[model samples]
Target: MEYEILGLPAWYYIAMVAKVLVVFVWVLLTVAYATYAERKIIGHMQVRLGPMRTGWHGLLQPIADGLKLFFKEEIIPAEASTFAFLVAPLIALVPAFISFAVIPFGTTITVMGCKIPLQIAAYADKSGGVIDVNVGVLYILALSSLGVYGIVLAGWSSNSKYSLLGGLRASAQMISYELAAGLALITVFMVSGTLSLQQIVADQAGFGWYAWRNPFLFGAFIIFFICSLAEINRTPFDLPEAETELVSGFCTEYSSMKYAMFFMAEYANMITVCAITVTLFLGGWHGPFTDAFPLLSPLYFIAKVYSLIFLCMWIRATYPRYRYDQLMGLGWKFFLPITLVLIVGNGLWISVIGAGNWLGSLFA
Candidate 1:
């Protein structure tokens, strides 16, 4: 017997396709401009000028950069594993795009009298969302863990010492810090009692639950943020690609679009992480007048996400790279232990008082 494909109507497919196109384009544009934002932000912080000639105030710099990379000659090393080398960039970039599938950008909107959620996975209603899954947090974590393999493959396939070392460093760093980051999010899971990101945002409808409503979670938030920095290989924890040491690390032999894909994956991951942070820590899509004006949800979400991204850039500009030993030590000794302790404390708090007691007005 043949299946009827979930018995869904044609309209559902059309609407889903529309949402996919919109989200994909938006994410791609955001990933491109994030590089520009970082350069400009750090430039101002360092009292120097960033790209100013590409367009008016460097507005088109990312576009120029993308085009330049697109048309560049593709080169493959003679001794490289041809298939894996080519596939690595795809592995790196695909996760960054697909992870957005589960992220909720805004609350429900009425389109043709049908309530549609801003999440790519499912439509949101009061009961929950209509997405493919209820566990968005886990979905993100899984996709994030998968992205590192591309780096490892790139390094290993290139058959270069620098690339191999970078891949090794990336694998180790991911294992070291991902634990603390995962544990830190336990605070959110415990308080929210669900792994659905959309639901987590719904629960944080106050002055941001992790920000003010629950003061204890703030510490874990910092730990989570630091761990995220390591996961994304940002400046201070960028040992995997430390230019001074590894000569471009995993992408040492990669050039043209392959090299570009690495950076694209990085920025896209940045956006994904910041979006997760907003959903779990900050009140997502909930700002002034959000109650009265549901249309403002996307704007609020975007504002909060960019604010977090800006904070990441600030940290990048201000902090110096940590020694490899110090990096491992911080992850293992400091962050891991602290996250465990915070989990225990949050468990106790939840058992005794409950989150709603902290800010009774926040629950949806």
Candidate 2:
């Protein structure tokens, strides 16, 4: 039985608040340092010191940058749509953070005679079993797709030709790649037989097959990650904000904290992409020694997430922007067909292996 307080379980409220605080702060800090890390990593790759003056090898740069942006003057284009211009940033930002609510960051933890899941949206049932948001995958997809609206609004509201073009490009890119990303995850859903992200991680245990070992999952992982980069407008797929072309794309007309919000949204989405990749493609929170020392689970999860984040940074440092035609061609002419092939091949493989076998679960 659960203890009730104000018609809700005490654990319920406590868990809810705790989950919000922990996940929010964790994601915020990660986004902050990710900027710093990117600057330093890319700087070093180019044989230069990144930010030596901002406190010991630029350790305080993110904070300093935040402070600078906070204190900076605000500006709205005289010709811009005031209401939409202001609302655009909030729209883009809220989804990036709120989507994490369904992410299973770690397995579980025991404290004060209760087991609390690390995911923000999950709750415990009467029997104390964990209950997660059943539509975690769809929730993420919906929120992610919603964010593109803000981009479009920002561009259109700005009343700038460049911003409008950038916004249009972002929407187009999102449409093209979002399908590939969703199709890739269909394989994951087929294999896991559940939309709950926590259950998907649970299913990947002991196999490590999802990461790279199993051919079908490995294919899905590759497509998913590639599409994720495109979805987030990362370089090699970043035609929307091609600096030389659109003067920073959809954000060209914004300045100060408003722009900072968009900046933060991009990194936050990057973190989100990395987290979901870890949860779906990699065995999340299940690294060695986590079984014995459950506390190690989140650490393992964080490590894997950062590793993927580092890869993103590395790719950004190295890759050139793709041309608009090239981007569309790659998505339609290439990725779409490949995803379909993977799905059909996965079905055939599962049929041959038989669902009773562990390998057959790739499409079950």
Candidate 3:
């Protein structure tokens, strides 16, 4: 069958390009400002001013930081492998940025009488987001896993003992937490009965947000959040880069824009995680009057994501870093068992309630 969109032959590839550019620019801007916000927030928490000298309330801090990094001296360790060392940052950075493509930012809008989705890619059935692949969840999982390669390569290529140790720690930490994170998502898959993120979001529209709708899902959310923090090597779980110990971890030998790439990648991953959390547990882009005002959909999504980002910063400011052993134990001894039990319990609950079939048909 010849596919059609808005009564015309579907030129989805063309539309896809346009959407990608818009989302790319939007994500870049968001990453830049997220850094600024984090510093400002942390400063206030500690009762100190942040970036006041750069612009009013440090409004220009991210730009200034970018410029400084751009102009900084590029340093390659004397013992480092030049090729791998140079490529490591790009490997770390690309996945984080591309993952956002599959994330649904908003609903559809009619532009010049052509119905266009706010998301860059949409499914054949017109669900929003980029590259509406049936296995979007798996795609995200695979891409996220790929980011570790950069860290590992950075450590090995740098020929620094400190970087090597930090990289090893990161690899171990990511593996431990990623299992729990993946398991937590399995519960979501079982409940929603689809791997398509846009479809998952659609299932949670209005009052059906899984975070509160299913008690088990709330537990999954907690597990996912904790595991995500560990996976991203954030505060309390940032063992790989323990400043006092690893001397800046896997990136110890990185300098200039190479260092900046890794930095940007971290923030990008943060935004990606927040976006995914909002899509799966929260209502994606659903909000009050969203049906009437389609533009409000992206706004709602951004608001939810930023709120979660603030929570991340709050935790960063409030908590101390976890001891290496404690971090491992929490992932394996604690979170693993909890998530395994929740998965079984959730599966049984869905079966008992016949939600499995119901959800399948509802979204199908």
Compute the lDDT of residue 111 as modeled in candidate 2.
82
By lDDT, who's the top model here?
2
Q: For each candidate in the order shown, give its overall lDDT on alpha carbons.
A: 0.86, 0.87, 0.86
2 or 3, greater by lDDT: 2
Once fitted onto the true fold, the runs of candidate 2 whose alpha carbons sit more than 4 angstroms away are 354-364
Candidate 1 lDDT over 56-138, as tens digits, reads 99999999999999999899999999999999999999998899998888877776656677788885444544554688889
How does model 2 score by TM-score?
0.95
By TM-score rank, best first, the candidates go 2, 1, 3
In model 3, where do residues sit more than 4 Å from their true spots?
Answer: 1-14, 123-131, 353-364
Q: How many backbone clashes does candidate 1 have?
A: 1
TM-score of every candidate: 0.94, 0.95, 0.92
**Candidate 2 positional error at 266, Å:** 0.2
Pick the TM-score winner. Answer: 2
- TM-score (C-alpha) between model 1 and the true structure: 0.94
